[model samples]
Target: MKKTIVLVTLFIMPIVVYLFFASGITNFGKLAMLTHDVSEIDFADSNVALADKITVLGFLGSDVSNKKGNAFNLNQKIYKRFGQFKDFQFVMVMPKGTEQSVDDLKAQLGQLSDVSKWNFVFGEEDQIKGLFNSLGTNLSLDANLGTPYVFIIDKERILRGRDDDEDEGVKYGFDTSSVADLNNKMEDDIKIILAEYRMALKKNTAQREK
Candidate 1:
């Protein structure tokens, strides 16, 4: 009777463990690490606080004359989903004096939601390029034609890449590619990162309580 019970328990435990993972009960993956740190940006004309914001950053300069790109619509969707978080922002880094163009672009896109959360910051060419380099992205100010890659930055100024820390999808260098399934996949990463931040906060709070 004892031998039969032990065999049954062993068989059931493996199946239970497999089902737990298969049912998405556990996410063993870690959140994406910061590829690089960003510096204090010299805003063109806004006083928006840089700290404590989850920013989706993009570039628009003489090289990137137009504001329309793959990131714009994706950002709108993200804002609709997560803008109520208050600290979330979509930052468009453009050249000084192109604020009008950005506004026009926003209007063109129908301004679906989170208009206040969309920050259009402008700076000189050199300042914008330097900021991009500091973030460890392979963006260029000299390229006449290139795709503006979007970056997800956390409150602590670390660049959050695709998925979690160990995933190969993380961007390490200059990448002009955009995700084909931009909305759903990137949104999932953003949620995971947000959850990670919240978990850290809870852990810190618990420590303080003790």
Candidate 2:
């Protein structure tokens, strides 16, 4: 009986768990793509390597100092957990002349976690607007080329976000100012996307092996 139970638990339970998620009608396990081909902007003074990377993209306004609390929340909730992933990165675009402020912000972020993958790209206001426009999102940049929202960009530069959001109908970006939103929604979505890639990689490897 002991050996039989172990066999059923190891084999049958795996199939049961897989089928449960596979049959989910909402397909909530997978993150939805909101925009396609978010062109990587080359005009930045400091450009992040966007090709073939999973990026958490944001725009920090001219007054980076004011965003300290939001930045800390992101670092603690998102970056700290996912920073170790090979292709995962945080790309924050800032209008030109925010370099010193960004550097200071980085210093503070580094105290919390390894901020190596935290990339800050500097660009003119026009350049920043151009990049943000390519996202094809309903959101708009503030006067200083910043918003309280940030987004998830897949390897192909496509925007991944919630489409059937109960509150917003079509959720485009994660709000930085809301810790509860980040903890409850954004973190889970991040996990899904990362797992999605890992599963794809595993499938590709298995195919190659076969």
Candidate 3:
């Protein structure tokens, strides 16, 4: 009995240590702020004011493929979920040559474009790439084709990541067809940040009154 107990304890000890470190590694921290002091990134329609509101920034390519449309479609789904709120905005940045597709893409909204809330911006390849790098977002884009990641930039221009997702800051491909994982995770994260912001505002107001 004594020998058996000793062997079991040794086996369980390593497992316990492994689980502890794994949880710590996956536990998300507060949203990360910009690595540099450039302030805000400029879009074609508006120079997205960081301190103004929460921004959901997504990227689309000009390639004749589904990746670009997948990212846009995901954005559409996100808008349907939170379009009525004026405090948030979704901006989609695409390659410059595809600007003509704006009309067709707008039809996907099933409503008129709310330029203030839903903006479709474009720029030269270099310009777009520069914006991504400036914000400390890892983007995989080229002259006409690339797979980019979606990022949540808070009011203070901080890049928000998940509290339990290890890859929250890692750039990955967007595929709306499989909406359960990526799309839902992002929507939930947005809600979490919005709630945190509201709570902070309330606290500030109370302090001011006191």
Candidate 4:
């Protein structure tokens, strides 16, 4: 009986640990959704060595029309805070027609603050659909789901988290009403992620000095 109990405990221990850390499991589906390599994106042209840059990729829905101000505000905050780290870049990808033109979006972003360090990429409806679908983000442009969904991608091209649980590969409908809250939540989450990156950089720098 003692030996049998020990075997059972050993078998269940890993399951318990995995459940505890399940949320940190990397989203492989989201990682595959990236259509263009961050290093090759046009905005990265001048900075080809983005491997050293901490990159954030945000995806907004088609319904985010006329909400340019909100988007700009969030991006501005992230840019200002993350810019403190060298080689850090933030890229906002949105579907076309939901907001204004790429230039208009850039202008709005610029208005928030001097956002010259960031890049804005505009995707047509179909292209955006493809991008999201590849990442398992289940909202469709035809369904009238507005923008506001966001995803964070690291320099290694791993998607940290998605706004909707369904987008994270779980079974469920996308939450339309949660976009605004997600916008707010993401702003805070990005800061934490940047801090983690900074710490990792510091550790590497210390190791080199030694």
Q: What is candidate 2's lDDT per residue for 20-118, written digit by digit as tens?
A: 335432346677888898878697665476779999999989989888888999999989877998899999988889889999999999988889999
| lDDT for residue 174 in candidate 4, whole number 0-100 | 20
Q: Compared with the true structure, what per-residue lDDT tens digits does model 4 show for residues 115-161?
A: 76666565565655554554444444345423444455566654455
Residue pairs clashing in model 1 are 138-174
Best-to-worst TM-score order: 2, 1, 3, 4
**In model 4, where do residues sit more than 4 Å from their true spots?**
1-52, 60-65, 94-100, 123-126, 138-146, 162-184
TM-score of each: 0.71, 0.86, 0.68, 0.55
Q: Give the C-alpha lDDT of model 2.
A: 0.85
Instruction: Give residue 113's error in model 3 in angstroms.
Output: 9.0
Which of the two candidates, 1 or 3, achieves a greater TM-score against the reference? 1
| Model 1 agreement with the true structure over 100-194: per-residue lDDT tens digits | 76667777555565477777787876777777787765445445222456677888888876433243554532222344445435555566666
Reference-based TM-score, model 1: 0.71
The lDDT for every candidate, in the order shown, is 0.62, 0.85, 0.60, 0.51
Q: Which 10-residue window in model 3 sums to the lowest lDDT? A: 20-29
**lDDT assessment of candidate 3:** 0.60
